[model samples]
Target chain A: MSITFKLDVLKPHQPNSPTLARALKQIEGVKYVNIRVEEIDQKTTSIIIFIRGNEGLLLDKIVEVLDGNNCALHSVDEVTIQDD
Target chain B: MSITFKLDVLKPHQPNSPTLARALKQIEGVKYVNIRVEEIDQKTTSIIIFIRGNEGLLLDKIVEVLDGNNCALHSVDEVTIQDD
Candidate 1:
């Protein structure tokens, strides 16, 4: 089974800064990561990360990675898996 | 691939009034619906809906359901599929 989460990340000191991409990749059990950047409050950039992992282990891995990163849990929603 | 969206609802006049839920189910092409509610700003409710459907048809169905509900698009994330 798979679970998906939407991450609202603080603006990277630099756009495309690898801090998030790298941190997420380091989280054990995260099978895939797709990050999109958005700006809210005009000053803070929100990094939206899409992730998939073992249903039993995904949230712990995600929370670990998000610790101390100024990240917020926007939402977590389950989805149908696409083979693509 | 499946796509999922997070919605920020502007607090229904009544919680669990079923307007949002029924409106969502009315949208064609939504295969599965799971809605979780959150409250922010002490008044507004944020709805997190999880759905499964044709990979190509999910978003349009969701958007149509969300139309004119004082809703805001929070984020859309993807995930791996689980047969369960």
Candidate 2:
């Protein structure tokens, strides 16, 4: 199955969107990742992330990566799954 | 060049998201399109549309199709262009 996720995340400035995107893309089944900044504050940046991947995508793993980058997973806004 | 656009749009329920996506895909040079509904009111649905295409994509044509389907283009949130 193919899965698509829309997530709300808050991150520190260091890794940045491109760096985060690259990290997400390196995951096992991820095909595409897009991160759009929604808000920027002194300490953190809020982003809307869209990820397209296969069933191998694990929410826990995604959260792990975000945690490693000093980011917070605000919410999993939407999830769509399609069978192959 | 490859272009990616994030747009805010409002549309009536008739055509639906999948239908609108199909219509947009038919436009010349379009490669990918994704529409996520953000809000739904009594009369309209607000959506965030992400479109990835080549340089041939014309904003006017996109607007024309949306107009024909009784949709309104609220705002263009972001635009990214990458040179090949």
Candidate 3:
């Protein structure tokens, strides 16, 4: 069983997008991460992130990771679950 | 100003420690991550992780990342803040 979801995130403009992507991929069961920048300003960048994993995604964990990265989760846009 | 901390984490035995190390390093301001195995069983592995960052480290974000990786945080052992 696995699941996928889209998240809207806001992060500071330092660490860069690729770093965030790599960080997210380290999550257990997380197989893929696609992050697209939607908006950027002097302080922060808004991104749309899609994550797919082999099981139920942990929302709290995701938030914790983002907070550590100096990022914020705005909303969960979409989700899909597949049982295997 | 920067801060460093040590975390005790328990995770499933699939994703290697290096992966977790890489993930933690991606957090903004995080300059280094050291993860050592404390114990391992058939189902999970216990690890001690140290993270150093350029500023105050966000505990919430670390937890989120851990959760996504299917890991649980047991305790935070040490902390140091350096102002530069």
Error in Å for residue A57 of model 1: 3.2
Ranking of predictions according to lDDT:
2, 3, 1
Candidate 1 — what's its lDDT? Answer: 0.53
Q: lDDT per residue, candidate 1, A33-69, as tens digits?
A: 8877666555556667776654344454676666546
Report, to 2 decimal places, the DockQ of model 3: 0.02
- Candidate 1's displacement at residue B17, Å, is 18
Candidate 1's TM-score reads 0.44
Q: After superposition, how far is residue B6 of candidate 2 from its true place, in Å?
A: 9.9
All candidates' lDDT scores? 0.53, 0.81, 0.77
lDDT of 2 at A28: 79
Q: What is the lDDT of residue B83 in candidate 2?
A: 42
Q: Give TM per candidate.
A: 0.44, 0.52, 0.49
**How high is the DockQ of candidate 2?**
0.04
Tens digits of lDDT, candidate 3, B1-84: 555667778989978898888888888778889999999999999999988776446777888889888999875544444335
Clashing pairs in 2: none
Q: Score the docking of each candidate (DockQ).
A: 0.07, 0.04, 0.02
What lDDT score is found at residue A59 in candidate 1?
Answer: 56
TM-score-based ranking: 2, 3, 1
| lDDT string, candidate 3, A1-84, tens digits | 878788998878756665676677677777766666677777988888787777756877788778879999999999888887
